[model samples]
Target: MHKYYLTHLQELESEAIYIIREVVAQFDRPAILFSGGKDSIVVTHLAKKAFWPAKIPMPLIHIDTGHNFPETMEFRDKLVENLGVQLIVGSVQESIDKGRAVEESGINASRNELQIVTLLDSIESHKIDAAIGGARRDEEKARAKERFFSHRDEFGQWDPKNQRPELWNIFNGRKRMGEHFRVFPISNWTEMDIWNYILQENIAIPSLYFAHQRDAVYRDNTWLPASEFLQLREGETIENKLMRFRTLGDITITGGIESDADTLEKIVAEVSATRSTERGNRSDDKRSDTSMEDRKKQGYF
Candidate 1:
């Protein structure tokens, strides 16, 4: 008799693929939330592989905070064009213009929190019953409590204390009308697992992830990119530095670290040895310990 078992990476890949397929089979209308970040890129790649020979079964949805890095926007457009997939952008600016959400004020203010309204608006407008995201449990404490098939009420509010159980890889996506679900196919994969998968798959990511020289300012113990949207403080000074983003989001809050990891090999090695969480550099999360949890409860991704 011959005995065979899947490796760790293989098992993770298989699980993710299975989850992706299940989303398609279960939802009336489904979409992948593509942020043009490494994690989302990996999820999109897995989606492509899961339905090989046929184009990905769902459209890609992007909630534009309007503060995204230029490189990230460019990568998003190019990837969508190349893949020939439909892209739906829910703009925060539009939401603000329509008086649906108010922008945060002050020096450290970011559009991150306001994204919740726009995201929910997009989902309701698009009639998307399931929104697949790249969020990983290991990335943050709030995310750690997420279910593979998370239920959201008619108002798109999440009840963390009232989540369904997923024992033996079984997921219950059943929900009534006016309600929806948030699916995370890569929920089990960690930051290291993501980098390793990206390296193994030769995936293309945003240039922001690689070390490069850019004008940045030290703020909140992290180097924030100096851009037109950034409001510098009284004592803050801008200078050129070699830095790379561990996580990407609104440029106003996303911070980069001094790094020389220009290639995937170098990045993988650095990630393996790093002790800090990926979102540690994000100023938005620093606002409160339950920041993500609070936002998530109100339908933020």
Candidate 2:
């Protein structure tokens, strides 16, 4: 008899693949919430491997905030073309124009909270029963309470108190009509695990993750990329710095950290030694102590 063991990366890969397959088996119409971020990129990669020799079964859904990085858009288009999968975009600008979602105001305003309405609208419009996301438990306090298969109400809101139990690796995806589910395939993966797997698989990611010279400004104790959407405060000034993003989001809120880790291996090593959470740079999470939790409850991803 021979005994074999899987490495840490392989185990995580296997677990994610299993969850993805379950979405296919359990839901009628499932789609991936692709944001072109590293976590979503890894989830999309696992989807490719989950159904190899054939095209991915579900379409990729993107809730466009109209504040994206140019690099992220380019990478998203290229990846969609290469994968030969359908891409569905839900535009927040359209939502605002149609009076569906109202944009916030003030110096710290962002489209982050506005994404909730756009996402729920897209879900309802597409009749998507299972919306697969790349949210990890280790990212935030709200995400830590999520299950492998999280259920949502008819209004697309999550009830933390009313969640299903998953014992012995079993998941219950039962839901009523007019209700949907948010499935997280990589819920168990951590930031370090994601980088390790990306390095091991030699996955292609957006250029924003690498160290490069960019115009940025220090705001709220984080280096925010200088963009047209940004309105400078009285004493604010932009300066060129070698920086990289640990996480990617709207250009207005996603902050960058000073780093020289341009390669995948270097990123892995940097992540391993970092002390902050991957989402720590995101200004959206800094709104309040329960910011993410409130968003999740209101159907934000």
Candidate 3:
């Protein structure tokens, strides 16, 4: 008989590292999609481990909606400086100013949808043949079907119905010129796995993830951050809530949930007991049942 020990988190980490190495070996100019979010930070750490003797051989690309939390931006800068890695930012503000994307006009207007154009433009301008993101399978129904090596067309469009099958560990990254792939090394991780990894590795994340008191407006069943981008519309209630962001996006649309999970252990407990998915706080997904699918088809990451 063979002796064995089972640790789910360790197995997942090993798989993620293997995918990271495959990205470096297969793509010509691959870049990581870092958003200062917990998942992205985990992917960055895995990439670091994948190439311990040598530095992580890729840049990080962030599609800044320009309404991100100040703490997230601070974390992004600090991580880049500490890791000595190149950081590239795609600004939605610049895209709007250049008329490449128009700002939506409404009380709940957000740049969440507008980010797609800027992201695709950034990818094209940089000639990034492969982009590594931190999307997980358990995050959403649409994402659950994603493979580690998801392909995109010349225009960066995703065809959900037509994805390559992965029978084993072999990945088919072959694509014609002007085509690319959006790789998700952590595609297999669930929320619990992420929290566990963060706890085990002692990884530092922005304080926004923890519960804290902040001024928020209760609208669209979410605690929208009281930023300049968000306004107090008629019949809206403002309150001082103890909230923590489940997922980070444009300040106008990313919602906060009431919680007191102020530590990693507490967060793990919270997510373990949670009912809804992380993207549930996002109103952009509420635009339509297939909202994420529609945007991802147009190159939204």
Candidate 4:
């Protein structure tokens, strides 16, 4: 007798593909939110695999905070061109210029929160009924409560307590007009799972993920990249250090950790031995315990 069972990675892949297909079937217009981060890259790859021989049926959406790393923008353009997929950029700078959103003040202020307005405006302009993202439950406490098919209001607001439940593999994507949904295909994947999948598939990630020498400052117990967008505090001093970003976001607030894990194998080993969550180094999350929750409530991606 022979019994067949899928490995953990295979299971995750299968689940994600199924979610992608469901989005195609359920929504009139759907798009994958591509941030050029590892998670979004994996999500886009799954979308590609989900509909082989046929190009992915949806465009990729990017909410550009305008404070992005140059490397991230380069990667985004190259990937979109290689895939031959449509790319939509929602510019926070445009939102600010148009007075739809205001920039935060002070040295620690980041445009991370301002992205919500641009994201919603883009969704409305494009008439996208569903937006697929690479968000994972294990990344944060607020995200942990997100459903595979998360429902949003006409204003794109997310009510965590009112989310639809997923039983077995069944997902309900029902919503009213002027409203939309946020679909997370990789919601079940973990940091280790992402690294392992990337390693297994030999996916290309930004060079910032690997160890390199960069000018950074130690603040709030994390290595904040020293960029022109970053406003240094009084006591902070820029110094060259070997570091790698555990996660990517606005350059102003995203922090890196000191490490020499240049190769994927070393990165996997480092992740396995680490005791901190990936978002621990993110200054945006450090603002308050409920910062992510509050943002999600206001329709942040």
Give the Å shift of residue 171 in candidate 2. 1.9
Give a tens-digit lDDT track for model 3, residues 1-301.
3558558888899999999999999989999999888999999999999999788899999999989889999999999998889999999999999999999897657888888889889999999999999998888777888888989999899999999998688999999999999999898888888998999999999999999999998877779988777778889877999999988877778899999999999998999999888888888889887777888888876
Clashing pairs in 3: none
Clash pairs (backbone) in predicted model 4: none
For 56-157, candidate 1 gives per-residue lDDT tens digits of 989999999998899999999999998888999999999999999998887667899888899999999999999999999988899999999999999999
Off by over 4 Å in 3: 1-3
lDDT of 2 by residue, 1-301 (tens): 2558888789889999999999999999999999989999999999999999888999999999999999999999999999999999999999999999999999889999999999999999999999999999999988999999999999999999988888776778888998999999899999888998898899999999999999999987789999999999999999999999999999999999999999998998898898888788898998799899899999997
lDDT against the true structure, each candidate:
0.92, 0.93, 0.89, 0.93
Name model 1 segments beyond 4 Å from true: 1-3
Candidate 2 TM-score to native: 0.98
Model 3, 203: alpha-carbon shift in Å?
0.7
What is candidate 4's CA lDDT for residue 192?
Answer: 99
The digit string of per-residue lDDT tens for model 4 on 25-108 reads: 999999999888899999999999999989899999999999899999999999999888999999999999999999888766
For each candidate in turn, the TM-score is 0.98, 0.98, 0.97, 0.98
lDDT of 1 at 1: 29
CA lDDT for candidate 3: 0.89
| Model 3 lDDT, residue 84, Cα | 88
Worst 10 residues of 1 by lDDT: 1-10
